[model samples]
Target: MNPIIELRHISKTYYLGKLDVPVLHDVSLSIMPGEFVAIMGHSGSGKSTLLNILGLLDKPSGGEYLLAGKEVSRLSDDELAGLRNKFMGFVFQQFNLLPRMTARENVILPLVYADNKTNAPDELTLLERVGLKERVNHKPNELSGGQQQRVAIARALINNPLLILADEPTGNLDTKSTAEIIGILKELNNAGITIVMVTHEPDLTEAADRTITVKDGVIVSDVSSGKQRTLAAAGSDGSMAAGFLTHNLLKLQRVRDYFQQAMRSLISNKTRSFLSILGVLIGVTSLIAMMALGQGAQEEVKKNISSLGSNLLFIHPAAGHQGGVALEAGAVTQISLQDVDAIRERVPGVARVTPYASGRGQVVYNGKNWNTRIDGTSADFPVIRDARVTEGRFFTDAEATSRAKVAVIGKTVQRELFGDRDPVGEFIKIKRIDFQVIGVLPAKGSSGWRDEDDKIIIPVNTAMYRLLGKENVDTVDVQVTDYNAMDDVSDRINKLFAVM
Candidate 1:
């Protein structure tokens, strides 16, 4: 029969930039079944690297390694993890226990990552087998160093792995604890399980079946267990049965158990767990606030754009030229109400027409004086401008044509002049003109550096003839029903105005 582990001409080299650092060179070794081997070496003898390679935790740069008649050097990362979890168990000198979990819970973690079968031996039973039955419910923090190592040993044997790799298992223990650990290893080896240990103490090797000393990455001497290998071969004709609890399939029933373990870990490590959860809460809150701000900004932009109406154009007086000097727009030429009426009646896509003229003025209410905007527009101002009167009513066509001096104040003007008092049916001064406050425009908020709700609206004829003493209007705000027809209507309006 072949040995359980075989290493042939193993070599390892590490690359540091452009230089190569060689560690091991041309080493061949073999380990048989049921053998308790102890590897000893000085500090920098590459024993740890050899142990890592032998345990399949790492691969050699150049070598062939066979485990149970199968070469596993070139396996993928996941395949190596599966093989390591299935056939091999690891024990370290530090006794890496999850500080939050009880001893029994820690012992069952290997099975969680392996073929966790429902019929496998109980976790408490494994702890009992390691002489930790009384300490099954106690955590690592509550146990002594020897007790912790015992827990680690119980965990190692949970999967019933074929090989046990113990790296300096007695490194951190007292003399009594170290002796107890060695006794456990000897007891395990006698029960048909194979063990390979790495230790620096020579006295610990007395219990091992064989002692191998390594020097400078090469095996200098090896002492066997004194068992002869020359014997008659026994013939077996029948094929062996395939294993059911293998590394292939996993159980879904253990998922809840694993989750419970996670919760227990969090509960045990209170400070670290709180910090982690707080980080998640802050991250989620920041994301939600940022999303709300982005959505609000987007809605604000769309609202401002929609308030101006869709595809509408403001028809202003064309600029005038005099003595080769270009005057500002509306300085020499003016648009009359006739053009506004014609565009409203003749333009195909024109939805509403409102003549506009405005100037700054001071308004006084209840002895409180404030400077504000005064807009002079027709009654169609609400339709063309998307303005809403939340308090009172807009001026009528009959009231606008008669230049009744009715006014609609913005929300900002309402707050500044009225001070929470109802201003509807009240009169305010515009350039010392007594204009009655008829309605209040809906709050439009701010847009970039401009306040949309700080103005007043009045009749176009009132502003053109009565307030400013101007005979013509400044601009005509036109609303359109169809966006696609805007270009055609704009061209026709320009041509008609040129002739008029």
Candidate 2:
């Protein structure tokens, strides 16, 4: 009989960091067609390594391997994969079924990688052979341990390969399931399919036609059942025989095999893949939401500031000023109404001017007390501050001259004092003075920690004489008619103040 598979002087070594360890040493073996062989070995006896070498799952560090009389050791990676796929199939100790796919889908997996003109048979035939005909659509988790292994075995035979490489196929089964699997293997061997199984079970070892024991990187014994079958050798048919595919087709086949394996892995470990995608989803969502909010805020700011219609500028007297004059230490008075009049008359393009004093204090009304911001201003306060009255009305020119005690409360004051009730006729106290809430200003949320709406507006003359006793306004707000002439207006205001 001729050998169907051969390993000559095969030695495989691996590196653990900088340390080299040898697993198989000068191992040589051969298997004839239609033979049932069992490889027996203790753990770490290089049995798995040898099985890997035979299955072409791992390349040996040194050796020559031949499959069907062709030198596979000299073949490239792609060539090796093609040869393995065409003539060999594998059954793992754990069954290695994809959890997301059904039993019938698992059985068809080998055919997806095999290059053949033949189509896969109906799911019924495969399921019937494995005794899983009634459970063809069941996923791996839905089936028992034994049923899953049977599906795995059906997958191994799907491509009609000449050899089956099973690593501890019955390791995870019960006595009944073990006997069932062993019987299936026997039936396959009887049908001209050669099998190479790795196991320590004496019953499984005895069932094979031959048993080879491995120990410490070498074959310890090789016992035969005294039965052998013939194998055909390659001839000049102008095309390579079985297990011999062209290099390009081999590469394409290997690429397909790799992707298929990757897909299987991802499906089997669903939680791991889901966790990885979750991390990416969170990062992408946060990044997009923040960018959108920032862009919206930027657009709103541009719109509001531009609507003010430029030409507006503010002038502050020197520190500790009252009127418009730059104050000196211990000086009695500084900025006064004269400064407001001066800017209106002398500044180029000057339209109107308003000067004001403001601060925070406690106010009381109707036996309730609350802290409120107070603003004292002229009749031009709304125009200078860019505030609008939503109801009622702003102070009239007569109210400014008479130093009226009437007041307009902001939107926040309305909410705090009246809740949902209308505050138009309500009364609130400001620094021991009773004032009427004439109107409510439109709300402007928070601007640099200051609640712009939580305040009351009163005539500046009243705030100075009736309550605060302040002699001068510290700042002057100027509104000009010609925005394009702002620079000239500011220069003229400076020139007019230079005389004092």
Candidate 3:
């Protein structure tokens, strides 16, 4: 008889860096229609890999594979996928059901992917056929290991495939569940579905019309079992008794197959499987840490900024204009220390004022230097910005009064200059100007496009006359005396800067 499936000189090789390791060496086999065959092998004997190749889950490195008398190895990818979908079903040891989907959805997924031209079977009929009519709506996690495997079997049969390739389909089930699964396979086999299973259990081989034993990547035995006495003796029982007897026998067979495939996968790549998990572990850890920090800092900033007073007003640079009003060249220099002083003196609703000047510059320590931010502000700057001192102290009024060459460094600056040691009282030069580090501010984390904690702050006067020598402040921020007066204070400041 012509075989339903045939393998010719099939060899599968996998690459480990530059070395080629052969798993299946020149393997050739054939299976006739309506046949129940099991391939038995020890761990690393290439049983599962050959099954994968035969099932089209993987392609062989070099060889010919034929299914239903059609050459599969030379077929294009889409053509192979089409053939596999139409005629083959795979039952894996782990069940491989989608955890989030109900049993019915899991079974229906293959049909959805396989056939697009016709309406597929609904949950009720498919579930009833698989004996899962009562548990159709339950998810894989909600069911026992046996039920999940049963669902896998249902999915396999849903396609009405000619061949079933089961790779250890009952590895995690109790004996009772194993029996139920094996019973289902026997019934399908009786219905004329050709099954090619790889199992380790000797009991499973008893149900097979043909058993092929493999060791060290070579077939050791390919033999047909004479009609067993037990199968023949079943005819003496009533029809129901005979049916139940055949069902129970096949259940033990499936359990054996499940363990055989699992042992092979586990022992064959002991290091690879274990090491693969480490990558997932590190990825999960880093992902969780990043999420926690981002969420925690966002909440902290929202709380801190909210407490700083709702009346606080911030100014961001506008390339065009405010309220969609375009400005002339340098028109926005409208914001200055003059505006800061005016807001403090003219607006009764304004509480405090601070001028902020910031741009990028370089910092030098010993012979090693780093590019960093340069910001110039006064003592009231921290008060207006609502910044807290993490260490040492903020610059004093006396330091701002004399235009002192003292500065406060942020977390990153301290790390770059002093490593783990304190940076306070240490002198560092920025833009060729030597200045003592008065304090180290706490890391405030990232905000928008800026790292607020990566800056080095100096007195506004020293920045104006000595380092930056800028004519006008880039932005001016003011705190209103009361939250209700915020709008009025802002209106007053806007008018004061209108002529600039």
lDDT of prediction 2 = 0.79
**What shift in Å separates residue 80 of candidate 3 from its native position after superposition?**
2.0
Candidate 3 residue-wise lDDT, 1-500, digit = tens:
56777789888889999998888878888877778888998888888887888888889988787665556676667666666666678898999998767898778767544433144446468678768899998988899898889889888877667789999876777888877877788877877788888998877777778999888777778999865422211112223222212222234444555566456556666898688778889999999999999999899989657534456876544455778888763465545566666667877787777777776778888776878888888787666766756777888878876889998988888888788887778888898889998787766777668776789888887787788877777766777778888777777767766654
Q: Model-by-model lDDT, in order?
A: 0.83, 0.79, 0.75
Q: What's model 3's TM-score?
A: 0.46
Clash-forming residue pairs, model 2:
322-335, 322-472, 323-334, 323-335, 323-336, 324-335, 324-336
Residue range 316-386, candidate 2, lDDT tens digits: 76555567676673264367877787777766698878877776778776776778888788888777667
Candidate 2 regions exceeding 4 Å error are: 117-119, 228-244, 247-500
Q: Would you give me the overall lDDT of model 1?
A: 0.83
Off by over 4 Å in 1: 7-29, 59-65, 74-78, 99-105, 117-144, 202-226, 229-250, 263-358, 362-371, 375-442, 446-451, 457-500
Better of 1 and 2 by lDDT: 1
Better of 1 and 2 by TM-score: 1
**Ten consecutive residues with minimal summed lDDT in candidate 2?**
234-243
The model with the greatest lDDT is 1
Kindly list the per-residue Cα lDDT of model 1 for residues 38-106, writing each as its tens digit. 999988787888899988898999989877656777877767777777777799999999887889888
